[model samples]
Target: MDVSQRLSFFAALFKVHENPTTGMWLLYITIVLLSILVFKLGFAKKLPIIKSAVIYTFLILGCTVLTFLGVFLPVAEGLVVAALILIIYKIRLHQEKKEQAKAE
Candidate 1:
């Protein structure tokens, strides 16, 4: 299918066209929240509030642009899913390392 058709397919999957702005906002929020979750669980325990705000703002903008361009729907979803899975795996590995240290 063409780009518009592919985008429409994803939009239909998520009912995005019913309320475009709301759909965009929801997608932005989802990306920000997932990114924060991954960062907190696998990388840093704390982020400066300003730094966090800036990062999320840029993320939302970037994702929104990509979404509007009709290129982000499928690929971004897959990337987010993969990132979440990686975050989970990293957390499990860290916990195992801690347990090993305790045993040792």
Candidate 2:
């Protein structure tokens, strides 16, 4: 509509990390990458380091796009959700490990 609104829209689309909330996004991404590495390392897999790195790169870009779409009321909310997901994943994994130990 107006020039200012147009500019803001474009900024949000391209400037994800410019917002402080993007820190949460980065944290979630880091967690995902680290988890992948841990899994591969545990199994003695070759560790597709290069491929996994690229995958994370694309995922970050995708999240930025989704953030711009107003998908989560200023994007920070999405970051919080991502963090929660990571927490849940870690908790579940810990429980599973405990169960396996008992069985063993």
Worst 10-residue lDDT window, candidate 2: 2-11
Badly placed stretches (over 4 Å) of model 1 are 1-5, 8-10, 39-47, 69-72
How do the residues 1-104 of candidate 1 rate in per-residue lDDT, one tens digit apiece? Answer: 54345553445455566667776666556655665565555565467899878876776667666566443356446547767787789889999999999999
Candidate 1 TM-score to native: 0.59
Lowest lDDT 10-mer window, candidate 1?
A: 1-10
Q: How well does candidate 2 score on lDDT at residue 11?
A: 36
> What is the Cα root-mean-square deviation between model 1 and the actual structure?
3.6
Superposition error at 93 for model 1 (Å): 1.6
How big is the positional error of residue 6 in model 1, measured in Å on the Cα after superposition? Answer: 1.7
TM-score versus the correct structure, for each prediction = 0.59, 0.41
- Among these predicted structures, which one has the highest lDDT? 1
lDDT of each: 0.63, 0.51
lDDT per residue as tens, model 2, 1-104: 54334333323444434564664455445444543444443333344889767765765566555544442243444344555676677789999999999999
